[model samples]
Target: MMTKWERLAHELRLKEYTHLIVGPGASFAYLTGMTAHVSERLTLFGMNADGHAALLLPKLEASGVPRSLQIHVYTYSDELGPVEALKAFASDLGVHQDSRVGIESGHMRIFEEHALRQVGITHLVSADEVPMALRLIKDSHEVALLQSAAQIVDAALTSTLPLLKVGMTELEVAAELEYQMRKLGSEGTPFGTIVGSGPRGALPHGGPTTKQIEQGELVVLDYGALIAGYAADTTRTIAFGEPSIEARKVYDVVLLAQETAVDGVVAGITAEDVDELARTVITEAGYGDYFTHRTGHGLGLDVHEYPSIMKGNPLVLTPGMVFTIEPGIYLPERFGVRIEDDIVITEDSAQVLTQFTKDLLIVGD
Candidate 1:
C-alpha cells in the first residue's frame, strides 16, 4: 500500500500539476486508501505539490475519513449549503485564484466544476487522463487480487453447472450462479449475470429472463465477481442437449475467433491489432454484422477501465496491464456464441487468468 503523500507526489510529478482532485471511485481509494459511500454531496481530496493533502467532505461524513490519512479535514454542514461550504474550505486551504489544479473530469459533475471555478480555481486541468495512464500498469499485489477474484468466479461457475438442467428458467440459473459466488466469498458480482438461452442468447448484453431452457438450444453464461475491490470477467457458451449443426458451427467459429485474438495479444502490440485478429476471423466466417460490440475492455477496480480493445484504440499492450478478450457472433432471432477469457500481458506472452474450460460443454435432459 502506497502512502497518501507518496501517491500525491507521484501524480504531481507525472501530470506536472500542483494539486490532485480525487472523487468517489477507485482513484480516490487508490490515492487515500479510503472508501466512502458516494452521495450527492461532493467529496474531494486536494493534494498540493508540497506533499501535503487535505480532504473536503460533508460534516456528516467527516468522521468517516480514515485516521491514517493524517491530513487536514474540512467539513461543511448540510444546512450551510454545499457550495458555500466548498468555497470556505477552498479559501481555508489557501487555494488561490490562479493555482494549477488537476481535476478528475470523468467524476466531477458540471455543477461541481462550476462551484470550483466560483472558488477561484481557474487553472484547472484534467487529471483523469494521466492518472488512468498510471493505473494501467498494475503491481504484483493487484495482479494477485485479480487472480484470486478469477478463482472465485471459476468456482462459482463450476458449482452452478449442476443446476442448469432442462426446464430451468434463465433467471433462476442466474440467481443460482450469483448465490454460489457469494457463498464462495465473493463480495458481489462485477456486473449483471447473463443467462441467455436460445434466441435471447443472441443478445450480447442480455440479462437473465423468464425464458426456460430446452433441449437442443444454446445458452450463454457471462458473469464475473468482485473480490477485494478487484474484478474478474469470463464467459462460456454451452449446449442444453445435442445442438443443431448451425449452432455447433457458429460456436466453433466464435471459439476460433477468440483463440486467434488471444494469440495476437503480446507485449508491444496495439489493442486495435489484437481486436482485428478476432474481427478478421469472424468476418471471414461471414458473420461480420453479427459480431457487434468491441472485442474486449480493461478490468480492474472498475469493471471497465482504460486500454479498450476495439477498432480504433491504439493503446500498446504492456506487462501488468489486464483486460478481457471476448469474441462473439450473434445471430438475429436465433442464438449467439461468445467465448471470453481474462488475460494479463506478460513480458514474453499473454497470461490467461481464468482457468475454466473453454471447450463447449453439452448438458442433457
Candidate 2:
C-alpha cells in the first residue's frame, strides 16, 4: 500500500499540480501527524509530485517538528518576516510565477496568499478536493476515535441535563456541560457550546448568553466534544418547565425529521437523498419556511468536512462515512427546535453513534 505522502504525490501528478501547499491547520495535521499552533506567524507544508516535501514555519516551532517526517525545513524569525523563508523553500522546489500551486483555500488567510505572491509563487488554485478526497472516508482507527468522542458528548449532556434549572443562565448551562465533558475525558470542544434559550433559540448558530432560562421556554443545546482529533456534534432541545403547545409541536416535527433522516441513511444513497428525507417531513408539516440550514454536515478530524447532507449534493454514501443528522425549525423572534445525532454508515445500515435518548426531554427544575 502506498503511504499518505505517496498518495498525495500521485494526486499532485494526476492534477498536474506543481506544488500543494497546506497551512498549519487540520489538513497539515492530518497529512503530517503533527499539530502546530495557528498564529500570525506563517507555517506551511509544501510538496510536489516528484516526492520532494518541505515545511516553512517560524523559528520558535523548529525544534518541535518531527525528524521522522524526513522533509526539508525552513524556519523564520519574528525580527524578519516569512517572505524570505517562503522564497528559500519555493526556490529549492522551483516554484515560480508560472507554477501551478495549489492551496487550502478555506484555511490559508489572505495575508498568507500575499506572502506567497511576494515570493513569486502565483497561479494558486483551490486544493480542497485533494485533501478532502482522502479525508471523506473513515478508517478503523478514525472510526474508533469518533465513537469515543460521541460517547463523551452523550455522557456529558446526560449528566448536565439534570442539573439545569429554570433560572440558570444559558452560559451557566453551557459551562456545566463542558465541565462534564472534561470530566469524561474530552480534551476540548470542537465548536462553541450553544445554549440558546427561548427566542434566542431562533439563532441556529447561537452561542450561550447571560439570558436566564424561563419556564415554558425551549432551550436548544447544540454542543460537541473533541476526543483525540476526531469530533462528535449533536443537538438536543429541552423544555425549561412546561413547554408551550407550539414548542411541543415544532419539537415533534424536528424529531420526526431527524429520525427519518437517520433511518434513511444507507450505503449507495446520495447526500441529497438523506437531506430530502428530513426536508420533506418538515416541509409537509407546514414549518417549511422556518426550517433553516442544511440537514447536516460531515464529521471527522474537522467538525465540518466534505459530502455535506444538503440539497443538490450528489455525493454517494458508502460504508465508514460519518456525518450528523440535524434538522431544525427556527421561528423568527420565537423559539426553535433542533434535533441532531451522529451516525456512521455501515455496509448494510447506518449506526447511530450517539446513544442519548431523543425523547422530547423536559429538563430544569
Candidate 3:
C-alpha cells in the first residue's frame, strides 16, 4: 500500500528517472504535510525510484520536518556552506553523472541547479508533470480541508458584509474582512484581500485603496482564506444604495453567466466548454469585451492550480477536481460585477463549496 508519492516514485523509476526534486511550494507541502518557507537557504525534497525520500534543508529548519515522513534529512550550517551538503545528499540518494534527475524548474534556484551540475548530475529535466498529475485530483481528506477553508471564508464574508458602510474606505473593508477571517480560525489570506469599489472594480487585480465607497456604486469583494494549507477563493458584488440601470444589467448578466458555468461543471465536459458557456451568455448580452479574463482557475493547496477553465484548453473535467467558477463583466470608467464560488466535481455532477449569497446585496446609506 504505497502512498501516492511513493507510487509516483515507482513510476518515475520505470520511466528511467533517477530522482524527482521538489522545492518549498504547494507541491512540497502536498507531498509532506509540513509547511516550510521558501528562502535564500536551500531546501529540497528528493525522491528516488525505490520510494526513498530525502530532505536537504538548513540545519535550523531540520526540526520542521514531520516525524511521519521518515525522510533522511541532510542539514548544513552557514559556516559549512550548502554546496558540500548538496553533494553529500546527492550521493546518498544515488544520483550520479548520468542519472536522469527531475527538478521543479520554477521553484528550484539556479544556485542549486548549478550545484547539481557540479556534483555530476547533468541530465536534469522538468518534473512539473509528475506533481501536477498527482495534485489535480483531490482525495477525501483534501476535499474536507478545502470545504472547511471555504466555510471559514464564507462565514467571514457574511459577517463582514453588514459592517460595510458608504463612508468606509476600501482598505477599511479589506481589513475588517481579514479580521473576521482570522477570528473564524483562518491561518491567513491566500492572497491580498481585494476590496474594489466604484470604478476600481473594473480592474480585475485591483487592491484596496484609501478612496471611500460611495452610494449608487458597485463594490467587488474578492478574497479568500487559507486553512490547513488549503485555500478558498470567493467573490461577490455589493451595491451601495440603488445602482444605475447599466450597472444592474451588468450584474444580472454576470450572475447568470456565473450560475450557468457552475451548473455546467459535470464530469466529461471540457474545461474550455465551461468557459465557452459563460462567455456565450455574456457575449449574447453584448458585454463580451467586458468579460476580459479567463472564466476561472483550479484551486486547492494553491489558489491557482491546473485545468484552467478557459477557451482553447481541451482539459476534461473529472471527479475530485476542485476549482472556481467566476464570470465577470468589467465596464471601464464605470463599475464591475463578478460572482465567484468554489466548486468540486462529484461522480456525476458538481458541488458548490462556498455558501455566500450570490444575490445582489443593496446596502442603504
Best by lDDT: 2
In angstroms, give how far residue 285 of model 3 lies from its true place: 0.6
1 against 3, candidate with superior TM-score: 3
The TM-score obtained by model 2 is 0.96
Question: Where does candidate 2 stray beyond 4 Å?
Answer: none
Backbone collision tally, model 2: 0
76-167, model 1: which lDDT tens digit per residue? 88777677767766765567867778888877777667768777778888888756866788888889889988998899888988777888
Off by over 4 Å in 3: 14-16
Q: Which residue pairs come into collision in candidate 1?
A: none
Q: Write the per-residue lDDT of candidate 2 for residues 248-272, one digit (tens) a residue.
A: 8889999999989998899999999
How high is each candidate's TM-score? 0.91, 0.96, 0.96
Q: What number of backbone clashes does candidate 1 have, counting pairs of residues 3 or more apart or in separate chains?
A: 0
- Residue-wise lDDT of candidate 3 within 146-259, one digit each (tens)? 999999988998888788778889999999999999999999999998888999999988999999999898999999998899999999999988899988888999999999
Model 2 clash pairs are none
User: How many clashing residue pairs appear in each of the predictions shown?
Assistant: 0, 0, 0
